[model samples]
Target: MNEKVVVIYSGGMDSFTVLNRALKDGKQVYALSFDYGQRHVKELACAAKVCEELNVPHKVVDISAINQLLAGSSLTDDIEIPEGHYEEESMKSTVVPNRNMILLSLAVGYAVSVEASQVYYGAHSGDHAIYPDCRPEFVLKMNDVCKIANYDAVEIFSPYLEVSKTAILTDGLAMGLDYSNTWTCYNGREHACGKCGACVERLEAFRDNNTTDPLTYE
Candidate 1:
């Protein structure tokens, strides 16, 4: 039997790229997205659409209560989503506390339940500065935890842990990924707010790659 892998998919550009990479690797892809009471449901919708288009099994776990319990981050709270480069200090307000950790923990359990050997996530170098959970160290430690916490060994496969966003975009383009179907705007408007940190970073990636972003911006 081919090794199966569970992808922590968010329907964002990075995670979408990771999903494609996993599919290209010939693994049975089970995508898991969380509806954690984030300010917008666009991402969830996009996730489903992407999965449907790719013919991949997808699950959206409802952990919206987590937002109420861990309120404060701009993503789950009423705070304004900051507009700046990802490296800006103000962008720290967007960090959902231990978000990747929580998501990966869930993914590990899902992987084990399905007897998958690997779990894939889209943590990249750009997120390491502000999001401690997205750093390589955290993923390595989490891999150890997964190995010990489960009867079967499940590896955390973060292919882009040290890769740049521009490089990721380049790979996605090579794979013919449709960027418009992926949602990255934190504001969750009908059109992307090009000023938000997520939007800025995505736009920068497209710019660096010398390609136009297919998504419309307000």
Candidate 2:
């Protein structure tokens, strides 16, 4: 690819894989993470660390306004993050409505500012079951909307959208992604609760991929 790629990173297993995948393929990477007033500022901080460690240009956008607008989720509020397996019941509590859309919109703007035409994300199909915004149809629609909304110069690419967490983990391992450097807990604490929806998903991904999590959890 001749054009540069900017990633919408969240410092979770998914976005870390997306960032690594782009870099492994020799794409010039500019990692974009958000300080969106989320409950877990730890994840954003992790994103900054990983970006620096990987020698990628990383910028944090202040989107507290957007988070304020969408505040029903446990990820952004005092509500407890659901624990257990990543199933329909457990995942629903973690959904921040239209979160991917807002994140991608900001990422597209950044990509355009940097003269980059492609933006990458890690919205996979497993998440689609819980997050309405991560679905293929929603991504396609948002891509079209962003193309027009972004002066037709910006495009979004979701490389893992059709796969499972196990599949994305396979790519992450190959790209040498430091799992310890990334954070996934929805709880805003010093340690992984090891029980939140995201934590559960991460554990399952590691198990499914026959990998191990390096982070210490309670």
Candidate 3:
């Protein structure tokens, strides 16, 4: 039997690539998504659609009940989503409080339940500046905690932890992945707002690769 791996898929470009990478590596993948009341459900929908196309087992865990506790960010609160490059300080408003840790904890629990030895997420270097939870130090410490958190000892695997968004996109494009199935805009609009930080980074990735983004934008 192939090794079982649980991928924390968010239906965004980064996680989409991670999900396909697991399959490409010959692992039995369980794609896990969360409904954390991020102001939009399009990413979850995108995740489900991609998983369906790949015939991967996908589960959308409803954790929206905790949205109140995780509020304050533009993603979960009434604050306006920031626009422009992600490196700008204003983009900090978009960071959901302890979001990655919460997601990783749940993914680890799911991994244990499924007897999967690994849990993959899409925390990349680009996020380290704006999102504290995606930083290398956090990942390393969380990895340590995950090791002894339970007897099963599931590993927190993040292949793009140190790579840039451009590199991630490169890998996905190399794998012949169609990015239209992914969602990156911070808002839950019918068309991607090309001005938001998330969209900027994603567009930059495609531009850096000298390819056009398949997703339409406003």
Candidate 1 at residue 91, lDDT?
93
Residue 107 Cα positional deviation in candidate 1, in Å, after optimal superposition: 0.9
lDDT for each of the candidates?
Answer: 0.91, 0.84, 0.93
In model 2, which residue pairs have backbone atoms overlapping below 3 Å?
Answer: none
Question: What clash pairs does model 1 have?
Answer: none
Candidate 1 residue lDDT tens string, 17-41: 9999999889999999999888767
On residues 103-157, what C-alpha lDDT tens digit does candidate 2 reach at each position?
8888888888888878998889777778888889999998888788856578889
Clashes of 3: 0
Query: What ranking emerges by lDDT with the best candidate at the front?
Result: 3, 1, 2
Q: Sort all candidates by TM-score, best to worst.
A: 3, 1, 2
Model 1 error, position 129 (Å): 1.1
- Model 1: residues with Cα > 4 Å off, grouped in runs: none
lDDT, candidate 3, residue 178? 94
